[model samples]
Target: MAAGGSRPEPFVVSSVEKVHRVMSWLKEIFGSQSLPPFEKNSETFDLLYTLAEYSEERERDASVLIEDMKERAAKYDAEAEYLQSILTETFDLSPSVLSEEGSAHLKTLVDTAMILDTKDTSLASLFSAISDRSLELLAAETKNKELELNLLEVRNKLTATLALENQLRMDLKKAEKDLEVEEAKAHFRLQNLQFLKHKSEDISIRIKSAEEKLIAIGLQESLMHEPLMKLSQKLAEVQEETVQVKKKLECYFNLPTSLPLARVKIEEAKRELNALEEKVSMRIEEMTDDFLELERL
Candidate 1:
């Protein structure tokens, strides 16, 4: 309507296109039949917008959770490595001759010498000192054997604790992967809902503009043009049908509304995991104490 310019094209709605395609396809497959109104289609777009926002928030929360788990996992991994290094440094867990065996051989030699020393008073005092030294060495050897056994017990407990920690780490990794998948799904759904809302707005505007044009033309002529009237009626029908189809499709593809449930479950899991981590920490501390005692011995 302006000089040297093209007139704006009539706004075509995607909802109308969707209805036309669905109706035509259905009609071809089956006979023409009346379809019921889908209430959700007539429902306000606010619901979709709200759901989109909720999904976005959930996605954000999941991302945060994933980051937190990664941080915790890294921390625990370092701690486990440190504990392992401490264990290796503190305990000499290699195969070697036991002190008891060597001490037994030394005791036999000392006993033979004691019998020989009884033949002369000159070696009597020297034999007494040797006897005392031999007894002291035997006592030290017995104490060393006990300490070795204790160290063995502590090492066994630490190994078991480390295994449990590794299992927890694996579980956390699986949970992280699951959260990532859920986040992707939520993001996809959010985009789809937003798109639908936008299409609905565009369709509504087009319907209003068409209706106004029809009304003006009919008023000016004091009678509706038959073809225009038919077209208007068809458009109205298409609009309604589109809404119903949209609702039905939405219902068919309903996204699972288990975000809150999942959150609750994840929180419960986190609490349990935290408790297990604390237990492992306590065990590590105990092992550290034992290692310190072994050093003193």
Candidate 2:
């Protein structure tokens, strides 16, 4: 507000090094041998504070004021020294004269000592304040370092966890792909088995139908063979009848005989037809058995 137009206040950061430096300087400042005051330019460096003990005005050159105070203290010291020298050197004086007439010089000596004592007390109080600030600063620094280390550890753990999570994601994807492949194979195998079963059923049905048809055809052939055998027997009997008629015609008209072996030849033809009929019956039975087997299949 005074010079920088209301800039935000700077944070007060104290350290042991700064505290030690201030203490040493304070010791020098308050020492009896040295000066009580070494103030700085207010325009260059801000004042330590605006306490009533220091001054009423806030904007003033502290260095000049402190120099003036030091000069006054030096003058008081010189007067006190000079008074002691006078007391030691000059002895021809009455007690009333020394007490009354030298009262002003005695007062100067007492005031100087009081100022020195006050400065020593002030320096000691300031040292206590510096020590407190130093310890607080050290504690703050340690806490900050601990917090930083904790954050680093947490960050590292998070990074490792992320890596592990990514690996798990990849593994999950692989498992999904494997599951898909197995599912496809299962589907294919199921369809193939279904097709084979259907094909087997179709083939079995066709074989049964073919066997049934073949058996029916064989049975029909057996029936036709019996009729064919009867026809052959009839033909042989007709031939014998024809020979007898021819012999009768020949004997009635006085012709020669020509029907000697007609009956024997008819009997031989009948035996051959019976043998063919038995063979046909056997073939029909074989076909019927084959048809039953096809039905079982």
- Judge candidate 2 against the unseen true structure and give its global Cα lDDT, from 0 to 1: 0.62
Residue-by-residue lDDT tens digits, candidate 2, 1-297: 477688778976344434454545455556766644655444212323323214434325676788889997897578656656766678644334677647776566456446444332244644665576779889999999999999999999999999999999999999999999999999999999999999999998886686567567554333243454665576567556655654544433432335446545544555655555565566556656745754564
Root-mean-square deviation of every model? 58.9, 28.5
What ranges in model 2 sit over 4 Å off? Answer: 1-128, 219-297
Clashing pairs in 1: none
The CA lDDT of each predicted structure is 0.63, 0.62
Tens-digit per-residue lDDT, 1-297, candidate 1: 568999788965465554555445445545767654434351333344344446668989999999997997696568656745665667742223327776586466546555545322235655786787789889999999999999999999999999999999999999999999999999999999999999999998887676568566543222224444664575567556555655544543444546776566556655655665575566556546644653453
Question: Which residue pairs show collisions in model 2?
Answer: 39-63
